[model samples]
Target: MTEAVEYDVVVLGAGPAGENIVDRTRAAGLSTAVVESELVGGECSYWACIPSKALLRPALARADARRVPGLAEAVAGPLDAEAVFAHRDYWTGHWKDDGQLDWLESIGAHLHRGHGRLHGVRTVAVTGPEGEHELLTARHAVVIATGSRAVIPDLPGIHGARPWTSREATSARHVPPRLLIVGGSVVAAEMATAWQALGSQVTVLVRGPRLLPRMEPFAGELVAEALREAGAVVRTEVTVEAVVRDGSTGPVTVVLEGGEPVEGDELLMATGRSPRTEDIGLDTVGLTPGGWLDVDDSLRVVGHDWLYAVGDVNHRALLTHQGKYQARIAGAAVAARAAGGSAGAGGVDTGRWGAHAATADTAALPQVVFTDPEATAVGLTLAQAERAGLRVRAVDHDLGKVSGAGLYADGYRGRARMVVDEDRQVLVGATFVGPGAAELLHAATVAVAGEVPVPRLWHAVPAFPTMSEIWLRLLETYRG
Candidate 1:
């Protein structure tokens, strides 16, 4: 039987972004319905962020201990991969969404488990799992938070080999003896870090000159060095000519350009991601299906006033934290627009970091790659700041030179860079690489997002005998 439901907001996916939007609108007294095709928590919870981080933590802990002489002797041993797998399974809830679904319900939002598509503006038609159909109408807005999927390059015999995508790589119960990972993004680097630690004879083939090409060149170099130090083989400037497998569950033979064929029990394609907009019926609404949707600073679809694309589908910034940040802005905007952009009637302020504007998406995008050396950066690189025509100077400091850093480890190895716009005298970017560097990223995020001037940053002193003191060093260097 067909059913119909209506709400003030109809969200298409219940990932971090969708869930947050629902929370915001519900807080504003709007009725919300979130339709999800898979587990309510989506990729990060089950596959990408949660499970991968859970798997990486033990390895990172072991690595950190090894760098400290006293701790090194205490923890010189292989990580129990099975125990780590158990921990990862627990974090993923064994691929269940009961907890996430409960949270949505508690927030007074409706939930529908099905494939949702746009039937028209502010209207959605969903096909449920058992072939049931439901029509959802939104009086205010329709949101596309469908996120993205890993892209596998087309090559001969690739499909026959049944290669693993991120889902398989992050959630696999057992480690393959020999693993070949393709691509050079965060997924490839982090997974290689985890699986190799779990005792896989791992080889990473990157089609580019370096891994993490999007970040500062040094971040990739440091991570690659750490990976090699951890006993994982890192190969760059390579291409897979073809692939062949005798059986679906058998080993894959990957032929490289002008090299010997490489065999592995599994191949993980971490190439990149394409938005999951293809089957969501964008054609019904005169939008191109299977392509990234464009949106304004308020997250509203460019031409469609009542349609908003938040998170990965919009192609603003693919990181989960960035998506959640956009969701907050978009959700507040949706509510305020519903109320004539006025206050006193559940409206919002649209100022920079006020209530509705998403200014930080462009001015400041903070990311932390949880690799061994922990590459964390916010805002633009030195090249990007210069290319933007901003009068910027990059100040760098050797983290090992810091007294606090040396005390943190026996032989501390890390680097920090802060890009300051000379005219404004404010930091426009920051990058930190080393063990325990992730802990210092939030300060940089705050500096860039708030556009704190370098002079004022000096007054905002970092606590001594802490990794955060690097901020003092950076500020001092700029002053010098």
Candidate 2:
């Protein structure tokens, strides 16, 4: 017979989303148990965000120094790749989760080590490495936070070749001498920046005409320019037809459609991501497995009050920070119901910006791509606003012409856009692209989320001689 454990909440997949949900549920005096098959800290901690940023920091620092006339000479030497790898290992805790596990225990949440599958509504089955079987039943809600896996295209010979995903690219101990990356989104642009800086001849192939297709077109143009300047090659309008590897120690040769075959020591597929919901037993709950789960604004699964899907699994926003945001909403929503109140009165006041509502997911979502010329945007793009039939005007400003930008970098190149809901006289969205532009995103996030009126925003003065002053320039552009 399988041992059975009961908790007020049982969370599957202890990623940032899962951790945040548990954090809120525990704070609400609910007993929560989290199960995981991989490291407790999940992909962002071990592979995606932490490790990738750790590797990119040195390169960005060097690039910044090279911009300064006096410092450029000192930074001309190549980075010590060995030392960089050691630093990344430190950031990722050497792929260990002792610290994270300790923190989870400190939070008074039970940790289960194994694969978790949904047995039924509010029921989960677990199997450990040693062949132990256990059943977990949740009194309140069962959350699917299993996150996503990188999608490797069905190219000929890809399975046998075993190309590197974002995991291997970020966690790699040694930078391959020749690296080719496929895809055109954040992963492609970021990996291209990282490996090329760390002494790899990085080449990127984008089936689209540019990088960062989701953001403003100029953002991709600028990053492609910077990547080339940094000694990386960017190829657009290309597709990988096949990847072949002969032996365990052999290199992978990638053949392209209508293009010459390119050989590389390693091939990194930043193609995309797929929800890891296939084996989670969604089919048992009358939902499709191996597909992105659907959820309501409150994050509860449609037609299943006791089920919730957060993070990349929901296909809402495939970003770590966004996943955490959704987790907070889900946790509060769960806690409210567990506290003997309806989801509406319990704490999920679903009004705009209500305590339990995830309003930003629709109107004020913010993203910052950590590239040399960072692309930051909050709320809608101009095209999106127009598509929504909002009577809006887009104001553009040149950061290169701003006093603060010139003082910060000898030759700074950046662009800013603010989309105004002309009928409402409020900002609906904003985008900033440049060096250290991410630092300016929060102010825009506030403006967009707050829906601050254009007239009132004029009084919110920006301190002069700082990157933030660009906010003033944008407002002025709109006024003019």
Candidate 3:
């Protein structure tokens, strides 16, 4: 007989989103149970964000040091690959989830270590590793925070070729000697930067015209230039037709269209991501299987009053931070509804930018690509603003010209752009591409999210002799 359990809230997937949901709901005195098939901390903890950033930090630091006058000679030699790998391992807790488990236990949420699927409305069936079956029924709501997986394209001989996804790229112990990357997204660019700095012959194949196609065009241009200067090949407008591998462990050859075949020890296909909803039994709950869940601002699944979807599974915003934001809103909404109060109807603010709404996902979605020249942006691009039918003006300034930028690095090269809503004279979007530019993003995020007027922003002073001074230069450029 299957063991049956009950809880006020059942969360599927113990990722950052699911964990945050548990944090909020459990705090509100809701009996919560979280289910996970893998480690408690999920992808961002074990593979994607933490490990990737851990691996990239040393490489970025070395690159930054090389730009400083006296420090350039000190870091002229190659990085210690083994030391870097050890650092990455340390950050990921050596791929052990004990620390995460302790945190969950501290929060007083029941954890079901198994693959959980929706059995029906407010119900879940968990299958443990030993084939142990357990049924979980929720008294309030069932939340799906199962994240996403890498999508490897169906190319000839691809499966047998054994390409690395974002998981393998970030977690691999040793760097490939000749690494061929297949896409130009954040994962590809970052891995290329990482592996090349670790003494690999990295070649990036971009089907699109440039890298980081999502950000401003100049961002990609600067990163590509830096990659080429660092002895890595950045090829654009290239397509991979097929892949060939000799054995289970052998060098792979990529057959390209209208170009010479490129050979490499390993290939990383950072093509895209698909929601991890295929096996979650959505079909049992009157929803299509393997589909992105659609949710309202409150993160409650549309047409399903008892179902909620957070994180990448909902397709709102794929960033880990954004997923956490949605989780907070969803957790509150679930708690409110359980108290016989509608999210917006019962003294809860569900209006735009309210506590019960995830307004920042669209208004001020922030992202930072940790490359040699970090590309950070909040809100929309100029084209995006124009597409949204906003009367906008894009103000540009050369980051290299700023006093703080020159002081930060010799021959500093980067750009900054602020998109202003003309009628309102407030920043709707901003992009900063340069060294330590990630630190500049939050100010931009606040300006966009708060809709602070340009005249009012002039009064907000940026500290001198810091990369943040770019803000003042940007405002001055706008004025002129």
Candidate 4:
């Protein structure tokens, strides 16, 4: 017999996306249930973002000490990778998903700690950790918030090879002596930086012309240079043909297409990630081409109407914050639907706000790469704007020329660029690269999101002797 439970909404995957929806739905007086197979906080909290950043902090501090005058001599020893892993473990609350579980319970959201699959259009069946079987039928909606998995390329000798993904790279106990990273995406660049700083001889093979090709060309150039400066041998514009393990003594040898073969002790594949839409019973509902659940403007899965897709499953931007945003909207939509209120109540379109909805993300999504000299970017680049047929003007400034940047380190060299709509004089995009630029991105994000006018932004003073003073210098350079 199927043990059935009812809810206003049943969210599959209690990651950040599902949790956000559960919290918001309960707040709106709607019954919500979340199902999970692993950590409640999801990938970013456990492996991707939090743990990776924790591993990078020591490298950042060491870099700061090296560059900051009077601080270089005070620093005594090298970073201990073991100690860093211990600290990462501590910050992750020691691998017990208890903290997140407690939060879910406190929020009045029922959690089924098991694998969940779609049984019907609005039904989810769960096999709990304790050998309990449960069926959940959502009176309002069933949301698929299952995230994505790292992509491993099909290369020779990849089989029987102990390759690392973002998960392994972020959680490994010990760093390998030599690491070969395939792909030039943010993950590849970041892992290269982190492992190289932690005493790994790193080499990155990229098929693109430059690293981070999706970013501004200047930013990509800067990142490439930074990787070389950090002792990473970066091979660009080369396709990888084969990766084979060298007998026993030499490192893993990776042969490039029309290029020389390079060797490393470990091969970390950072090709990319694919949406995890398989085996969750998406076919029970219906899936679009490319395995994405068909969703409408209101985040409703087409045909079924009550079904929705959120997070990476929707095949939208695979970002943690964006997924949470989708969840909040989905929760609100469910509550609105249950209240007999039109999604158009109070001029608020619940559809515009909920499951699989990433309206704001399209306009204000931000990306940051925690490289040695961190890189942060938001919105369209100059080329992107031009490609979109918008008239844009760009102004750039060097970090060393900014007073705030000067105080942070003796030989600060970084670039800050803003793309502006020539007519409205509002920023469309911004990129900042160099030490301390990661923290400087939010101000730019706020400016872009608010569509703050350039003249009005001039009055927004940056604190003196801070990295953000580059904003003022950038504006000045633009005016000059």
Model 1 lDDT tens row, 12-117? 9999999989999999899999999899988999999999999999999998888887779988888999899999999999999989978987888999889999
Summarize candidate 2's per-residue lDDT along 1-480 as a digit string, tens digits: 377889999999999999999999999999999999999989999989999999988988888787877888999999999999999999999999999999999999999999999998899999887878889999999999999999988989998888999999998888799898999999989889889999999989899999999887888999999999888889999878888886987988889997578888899998899999999889899999999998988788899989999899999888899999999998988998887767455555767787767888889999988889888999999999999999999999998887888877889999998999999999999999998898899999999999999999879888888888887888877777
lDDT of 2 at 380: 91
Task: Name the 10 consecutive residues with the lowest summed lDDT in model 2.
Answer: 341-350
TM-score for each of the candidates: 0.97, 0.97, 0.98, 0.94
Please write out the lDDT profile of model 4 over residues 1-480, one tens digit for every residue. Answer: 376899988988887887888898889888889999998888988888889899989988898888887788876566888899999998787777888888888988898889998886789999888888899999888888888889888877776466789998998988889999999888998888899988998999888898888788877788779789988899888888887886644568788887578888888999988877777777676553237665655556777768877777776667787788777776666666777756445333744324424566665678898887888988888898899888999898887777877888788878999999988899989999988888988898898888899999899998887888888888888889
- Which of the predicted structures, 2 or 4, would earn the higher TM-score when compared with the native? 2
Off by over 4 Å in 3: 1-3
Among these predictions, the greatest lDDT belongs to: 3
Model 2 TM-score on a 0 to 1 scale: 0.97
- What is residue 226's positional error in candidate 2, in angstroms? 0.7
Counting only residues 3 or more apart in sequence or on different chains, how many pairs clash (N, Cα, C under 3 Å) in candidate 2? Answer: 0
lDDT of each: 0.90, 0.90, 0.93, 0.82
Cα lDDT for residue 256, model 3? 97
Model 4 CA lDDT for position 219? 77
Backbone clashes, each candidate: 0, 0, 0, 4
User: What TM-score should be assigned to candidate 1?
Assistant: 0.97
